[model samples]
Target: MASDTDIGSPERPTRPGRWRWLPGSRLGRLIIVLNLVGLTILISGALVLNELRRGLVNARIDSLTTQGELLATIIDQAATVGEPEPMMDGAYAAEILQLLSNPRSQRARLFDAEGRLIADSYWVSDRVEWRTLPPARTRGDGPGLDLNLSGGSEDDPDSADAAKAQAALRAEVNTALRGVHWAGLRVGVDGERVVSVSIPIQHVKAVLGVLTLEARDVDEIIAAERAALLPFILIAVAVSLMSSLLLNRLVAHPVRRLARAADRVRLARARAISVPDISRRDDELGDLSRSLEDMTHALSERIDAIERFAADVAHEIRNPLTSLRSAVETLGLVEEPAARDRLMAVLQNDVQRLDRLVTDISNASRLDAELSREAPTPVDLRRLISDVVSLYQATARLGEPAVTFTAPEGLETVMVSGQEGALGQVLRNLIDNARSFSAPDGVVRVALGRQKGQALIMVDDDGPGIPPENLENIFERFYTSRPKGTAFGGNSGLGLSIARQIILAHDGTVRAENRRRDTSTEGDAPEAAGDIAGARFTVILPEARR
Candidate 1:
């Protein structure tokens, strides 16, 4: 139930709330998370920028290669004719520059046989420095273009030049140079790729002079690519940072807080999980935190109960030891032989009582220890109860009480998993103990049935009921209703304790409390008011391995 005060208004708190995040701890996580995110963003951006630059460089190389080949073919036609020299006058260089300045061609250059740059479209001057380029070769053609001598080949030129180093290319070109056709060649710049083509001057298919074509518009290609990469890398870094922080808030922080809370709980600094909710958003972490908090609280209560029980057990055993030792000493000091015999008999009984107490203590302590070693095997619980009730049938009939076993309709072969001997002993103890306390001609009923996944065995007795205060402790080791020397009815105080241990070993539980007459019996309200009711022992065991 929630109180009116617990219900809240729509308004939010004005000042800072008693912090949801851990003080002095969240700062470190924040610093680490942000630093890691920043590093990732920076590295990713650099890699993306590098890839964009590489792609742009590759595209520019292809464009430059094609433009250079076309420029070489145009230059070769103008220079190859000996009768009229357009290239020799050098005035047509401006017209060549204008042609090469087209935006589609991304590079431009003119080279002589000595690998000297004769002109450049971007330089804008005929007096531009003739830059030296790395040695290159021009392809050759057939020997049909010479007009000077009868048997002279057009390849035997008069000029002795460095371009003669291209002898391999010359042999290939000689096959095609006898007729007008294209001659492919390359001239290496410092680092850039330059495509160029050659044409023959001496004959329709013989090499005499070379003309090369190139481009000068490479800057636009590089600039356009850089423009997209710059913004793309910047935006990617921003998104990575935001996503990392969001993930920490939604996922990492809650898990870390739960682990820290568990550590504090192990040290007993906190009774339950006291960490605040880091995630206010309705999501999976919210449900996990709630579930964990509930489990921690329940576990803490169970542990506290076990500790208190241990203290009670220790206190209960001390009184029995002191009584046993005092009785032995008193018997030794007696004088008369007849009196001595009587005292010895009394001492022997006390000794047996102490022995029973110690045995019960040892057995109860090891209940869980034994169960953890192995799982119980399946056995017929119906036969076990019948055997136990039959064993106690003579004692039960001493007072002429009615001892009846009522199992559910298909229970003759009902099976559950457990230690057969221990389980049978528990049933026998429950039945025998109930019989001893019942009124003459009263009914002691034993019932077995399957409910859900558990085997429920119940024993009901007609007798003076247990007091409410002692009901919970009756199954504890060494606990008994009768004081020592009450001969009317007192036991070794072991029957119920042993029964509980056996049940627990099977991973089950046994509880004893007064049975309400209205619920358990026909036409009887006496037990309902706590006066003439009987005690009921209910045992719950796992049916699959029960």
Candidate 2:
């Protein structure tokens, strides 16, 4: 039960809650998707690099553990003393740890069974840790005046950090003293990340001390891995930028142009839309451009037709009004009885003509809306024509022309796709037109047949044929040209025009042609040679598919 406006207007429903926050424009959405794609790639690279970092850490731990175990075995054999309960010779273990440690990459430390730090490889190798001193305070005399030159000041931040590392190292040594080997990541004495391994120094099933090895280059290795992931991030960013630009140029901008063109049409700034560049593209947008242009063109043409129809109606109505006014004025002046009677007749005729013109104008104006409102279905031309001809014959007077119908042999029905009421009106209009032109006692033939996949309906009359020049003009609104002795104003001239309009709306054609007879045989009359018999109105409608 939708109204005409509801049916004709395009839908613009509100967006659902979940999608309401999303960008409404195509370019905005494209940018979001492209950036997300790049971010996904960057995240995937980070995940892969994370796995690599774990593998490197585990490998470093395993390498340090192997070295620590070997050093612990050597220290147990070479630096152990005492009888059944073995004791670690601190001095001897320190000498052995110094000879075996590689101070450039690793630091070796030894803790006693009491979990006390003993031999330190950094002190034994005399490796100096270099650092840049901070700027001197304004209260000091020189740049190094307030610097904490003492390595283990209680108030120093480095001292507090080193204390935490020492406590963690003590825990690892205690665990090793229990005869368990440990290797994993931990904080070094210098407050830097390192991979450390602790192995027990045992002799003859007696726990002596713990030997620990730490690799302080673990942070450097992770930094290098992160640096290697930079190229993938750059590539993903570049691709996202390129995709956004391409989409804006190829899709977003063209769609914006189409919208602007439509706006021009809606605002009445332009009669029709014509975007040649967009229409040339071989895509859906191109199709849309072409369709818009066609629709606007059709609307413009319809406006022009309506304007012309209004002007024609005004002109036709004015003529009758002028005549009626003149007749009324003259009737008042006329004195003779015959003159008064003639004036009365003229007034009546003018009134009748005006009424007929108004009725025809009303019908013509509503023709478009009626045709559009009624949906088309299969219509049998044969039955429709027969019914119209029968009605004319049933109402015929003795002096009127006889109406006859004929169809092709073996043709049961001539079916077409059209509104039954509209098509029936078309038949009625054509028959009435033909009867109006026919002479009394003459025959008007209504023929229906199928030709070339079309249902053909021809109405032929045995009257004066239409002039060749006016054949097309006869279908124009308010055009009437009657022969001699015909009653003036009896025909409103809208029947043929309305009939043609109806047929055109049904995707059919109607035309007036002169029906000619050939007298080329050996006849006695040569003056009747090639004579024009009468006017034939032919209607061709596409046949309905079975």
Candidate 3:
């Protein structure tokens, strides 16, 4: 079971793990997205081109099969001879093969029923097969190659390749002789890839020969498809590079500059962080930069204030210590009883002063901690002021000033948002200061009311008003300027200062001003044109919203 404050507190963010490196920074994420976009396009193009290549290969095989079937049928009808056991006429089939035109990229071959070659489209059409020959071997190129000089013999590489090609052709022809059509990819005699289709020539269930058609332009088609994909690859690469450069300029560099500025502050090279260029931007980074600058500035001010406070404490404590030392030394030197008694009285007064100063200093030092530790809540000013005045009335002595409280007519309470205890301490300090300065038999008035949108509490006393120039300085630490006839060493001067500090912590203001009265009438005294009546201390706090 957690309290509301604990439940609402934000948890600390966890650091990223080592394996999650891809999304570590803004630039890294941007680069991933940009590169992925290019990769997606390149992959899609490759997939489409692969499908096109498959389709082209299938279409080429089908076209060859159709052409081969028609030619086989024509040859079966025109060139088959003999009764019942019909056989192909090789001479006539050769003539028919020569008469029919084939595509330049395609070749047609014919074989007899005994698996013997009868005609070839390339030879019948007199189509010359052109190929680049390897360079002739020089006599000095190798040491032992000259022993086997014969070319195109049974032991030659070309002879072995030709024999292998003939065997594969016979195998294809043998399958067609069984009256089955075979169509697929195979290596041609020149070791180039081709789509080949074999069809059997038949005359009324009598097998005669086989005709095979091959398309040898598959490699060229695939090369063209690869060339078409080059432009997509280049575009994708260009997009990725441009995106990387843009991200570095827009996001990476500025963030780097901010990091450097923070390092400078941490290293004590600068008192406060200031990056005007980044701060001027209208974005979250800009807000962050400005916030850093403000935080540093505030911390610097607080450090300076603490230094000043330390110096002040040392100076204030020295005075009482000096007096006490002097009094102690004089009491031991005096011989007569009356003189020794006077020295003893001086010693006691110095001791009391030191005690008062120490106590006030301790409270002043703890003021900041107390204010920070306590949270603010709505406080009824009427009840707080009434309680303070009642406490003073209960402890009043003979001939002392009386404490009184007043609120706005018809208003039961005036509310402000502040720490109740701290606010009560502020009211008590103001009331005590007023009572100390008040004239004998005079009343110290504590008034609470609302003005505009603020809750105003004013403490007034019927005594000699403060000097106009010393009004602001009165709230400064250790600034005590009591009037004549006031008891000596009775005030520590930290009361008003502490009050002002508490009011400021609550986002309120406290100020001292003299109450004046105008006596500019015909019967009035001429010297009393404007008389200072009393000193008024007003504390203004923002009204708590309903």
State the C-alpha lDDT per candidate: 0.59, 0.79, 0.79
Candidate 3 lDDT over 419-520, as tens digits, reads 888889998888889889987789899898888999999999988989978999999998999888877677888999999999999899999998877756
Error at 300, model 3, angstroms: 1.5
- In the range 1-546, model 1's lDDT, one tens digit per residue, is 111122222342223333335222343345446656676777677656654565555555555546654655555555444554333323354366555654545334343333233554545634333444433435663333332211112123332332242343343234323434343333223222333333333333334333333332334454565676668766766676666566656566566666666656766778877656543547777777677778887788767866875776666666656766776787778888998887666667667766765666666666656655656778788888887777667554455667788887756667778778778878878977787677677888999888888889999998777887888788865567853335421365667977987887677899988875544455645545435478898999887632
With candidate 1 superimposed using the best TM-score fit, by how many Å does residue 488's alpha carbon deviate from the native? 8.3
Q: What order do candidates take by TM-score, descending?
A: 2, 3, 1
In the range 1-546, model 2's lDDT, one tens digit per residue, is: 122211122444323333234443455455657677768877787867664588888898888888888898888889988886779999998888888847478878788887766777777666676655433456644333122111222113334665577667767878898999888888765677878998988887778888888888877776776678778767877777677676767776677677767766776889999999999999998898899889989999999999999999899989889988898888888899999998888888888888888898898899999998988899888888888788888898998889999987999988899899888888888888888888888899988888899988899998899987899999998899888888766778899999999999988999998877875567645534578899999999999999
Q: lDDT of candidate 1? A: 0.59
Each prediction's RMSD to truth: 12.3, 8.7, 10.8
Which residues of candidate 1, in runs, are more than 4 Å off?
1-54, 65-97, 110-119, 123-273, 276-307, 329-341, 369-447, 452-454, 460-479, 482-536, 541-546
- Model 2 lDDT-worst window of ten: 146-155
Clash totals for all candidate models:
25, 0, 0
TM-scores of the candidates are 0.57, 0.65, 0.60
Question: Which parts of model 2 have CA positions greater than 4 angstroms off?
Answer: 1-229, 235-239, 246-270, 274-287, 373-406, 409-415, 440-444, 522-530, 544-546
Task: Indicate the residue-level lDDT of 107 in model 2.
Answer: 77
Name the best candidate (by TM-score).
2
